[model samples]
Target chain A: MGTFHDDKGELHGITVVVETTGPRTYIGRCFEETEQGIVLLDVDFHDPAEHDKTKDEYLQHAVKFGQWKKLAKFVVPNDEVAKVQRLAELAP
Target chain B: MPYDPEMVRPMREELSSAGVQELTTIEEVDASFAQSGTQLLVINSVCGCAAGGARPGVLLALKHSVQPDRATTVFAGQDLDAVNAARAKMADFPPSSPCLALFKDGEVVHFVPRHMIEGRDAQSIAFDLVEAFDKHCVAAS
Candidate 1:
């Protein structure tokens, strides 16, 4: 039987949260979705709370705030992702 | 490992100065989140989405009444090893800095990736985290 997921097809151009293996999550619109993997455009990264209290006391004492251009795209290996959640629609 | 520490120090500080811990090595990352309880992982990055959205949101979230028992960070390009190790704990999640995760008993229960960060402003993102913190990071008796 084919493992093609029809729901992925419906998410084209829609904003989504790609939750993958490592339980990592990516936010973007699906550029391509096949049985192999998924592609995203205008990617941004995410982080959750964890430990680093000691590290912060050291490194944080020194850091810079220069601006950075956002990454334009990214792709996720099929095996890495767990599921994709659709987010609220953006203003057209 | 990728960017010069001097170059990105300020951006990294934006988070640390706010009381978020920084994990620079694999071991450090491992030990930090190894504990069992509620934790918040803030993936620090130098991208626009981070500066314009994630950073501000996280700092604002800190001001809320309820918050995580612990909060920490790993820079994407600069702290590659630490970031990789931290993400590894997230179980198969793709690598994205400027990300946020909320862990319950060491398992990631809530997350805010870049897609969620890029579109919203600092206030909106903070509102989201505040809501999450209120829901999950309440102080223990």
Candidate 2:
């Protein structure tokens, strides 16, 4: 998990969670807000073949809408990564 | 389909002519943000907001005496990886194309999301940004 700080060096109350979805790559999500920054909870979903494409697709959507602010990512542990990976596999 | 390089070329030139750097890679993004002063990152797009409002707002804002130390842009659809790379560096904010990010020493200070620019006119947005610049960029000292 990582935090995003503002200009005053104060936390933006945002947390980013990073979960592994591949060998070296991770998927991150925000879960809580803090005075210093946001807290992240990692999700596990580590299927390279599946997650890679999905990641690219999500990024493409963000790019298309000029929604670049939504693309923050972070790195995290393997177990947490696997959880999101499994979840992604089950996702419709 | 890919964007028309020829069409965007002119727009790119206009910004460059105004002294804005074009960040086409993650490294460039890092370098620009890592610098020790206020920076303006423009999420450039071909949408109506970009063409009708954001671009003009940027031009007007640049004319302000109290502006950022540096100004840069990334073409959304055209510069896919570069845009994504830059977004990753931003960390928390949700993605909003045709967006405007004000960074001071690699940290995001002010963000103007797409919704903020969507229906607004150039002058109005420029006024907002210039105000931000005056407060954050100039008054920082």
Candidate 3:
């Protein structure tokens, strides 16, 4: 766990994924982290609802540029997180 | 012990209406856990956040080109045994309702917890699921 925070600290300016208790997923720049959870600077959120598949997956594109109609800052509780992974470490 | 079924009917319907099968008993969970295939077990909730994002996001992700072989759901605060059984399969993950459990060959591969759903948008949630499906679902390969 000690090494984990150090690794996360290095990602302060980089992108990361926060997986929370609802099993929800959020992607954004690593703003800051605490004992509770990480605060994502410009997060793009995920949920399980139905929408048009034919439409372009604009959100994925939004993630890279940090564009989305969402709350600018997301504070994730450590207790609610299942895990956190750097975007670069995840499969494309 | 179980929740008043009538009180949780709408929340159950939200996902059931979205084609998510409800898991009420531990036996059903045990059976599902034994099956081989990519399985998505969503721990459903009554929170406004879930209604706004998690549920909608998940349903959208399932619409992708590839998805889990079976998608099931357990209602938090309602189906006690089923939720517990599902969490038991999750290894050490702390219990969080409105979680997304992605399983591969009966092993918990990816899990999404409630804190993740709190303030995220539907599209963001959808993107995560699509990526998970691509990387974890055998059918996607």
Candidate 4:
């Protein structure tokens, strides 16, 4: 199996949906990756605990409509992140 | 291994200068949590967001009239034992450096993880920390 390091630069500049182990989820353009976390630019982060939309509903809407940018840049820690995928791959 | 003590001296001093006690050993961590009343525990890190936001924000928050009974900090890379002990106290929280937690009578009442720090200015961070302080901390005479 490849290490997390192997995928570091490959995702740069791609619009990806990132789900974390915590309450938040992010959809943004991957700017950089470090041992610490993935740096995302123009991110739309949603915490269902504080928002009206469920994670599934948000993902569905984002897949069809595209992400709504909220944060200009942020880091989603590697340990807290559950999954990261290309936004285009989610299209049906 | 711990970070070069000299290199991280300034980072430690930033919080220490603001009256946050440094917790460098497991014993210190245990003793601090054992105390009654509210305390603020900062898991310090060398990350840029920490330097730019968390530390400055915490300093500003402490200026509020209402404040925790005590404030303490543990360097993430330099104080391994204390950091681990602190994390054990906050088992519910996912481990993250540049994090902050408020404890009342030994229970965590509020927490600010690294994600909340990233991409924010010190003023924004201080605003949130002050909100937590107002809600959870009591004013000292």
lDDT of 4 at A63: 58
Computed on C-alphas against the true complex, the DockQ of each candidate is 0.04, 0.07, 0.03, 0.07
Q: CA RMSD for every model? A: 14.5, 14.7, 14.4, 10.5
Q: Per-residue lDDT for A1-92 in model 1, tens only?
A: 10133465665544566766673456665667877788777664343333333322311211111112245777888888887765433211
Q: For candidate 3, lDDT tens digit of each residue in A16-92?
A: 77767783577766767878678887566766454342112534433222334256788888888877776544423
Each model's lDDT: 0.70, 0.63, 0.71, 0.82
Across B12-61, the per-residue lDDT of candidate 2 in tens digits comes to 67677888899988888777776798899998876656777788899899
- Per residue, candidate 3 scores C-alpha lDDT tens digits across B66-139 of 88988999988888878888878875664555678789998877776655654578898889888989898766
Fnat for the candidates in order: 0.02, 0.15, 0.00, 0.00
lDDT of 4 by residue, B21-102 (tens): 9999999999988899999999998866688788999999989999999999999989998999999998866566688898
Task: Report the lDDT of model 2 for residue A67.
Answer: 29
Per-residue lDDT tens digits for candidate 2, residues A1-92, read 11122342221221222333444333333343345433333322234565545655543433223223223433343343443221122223
Q: Which has the greatest lDDT?
A: 4
Cα displacement (Å) at residue B35, model 4: 0.5
User: TM-score order of candidates, best first?
Assistant: 4, 1, 3, 2
Models sorted by DockQ, best on top: 2, 4, 1, 3
User: Order of candidates by lDDT, top first?
Assistant: 4, 3, 1, 2
- Give the Cα RMSD of candidate 1: 14.5
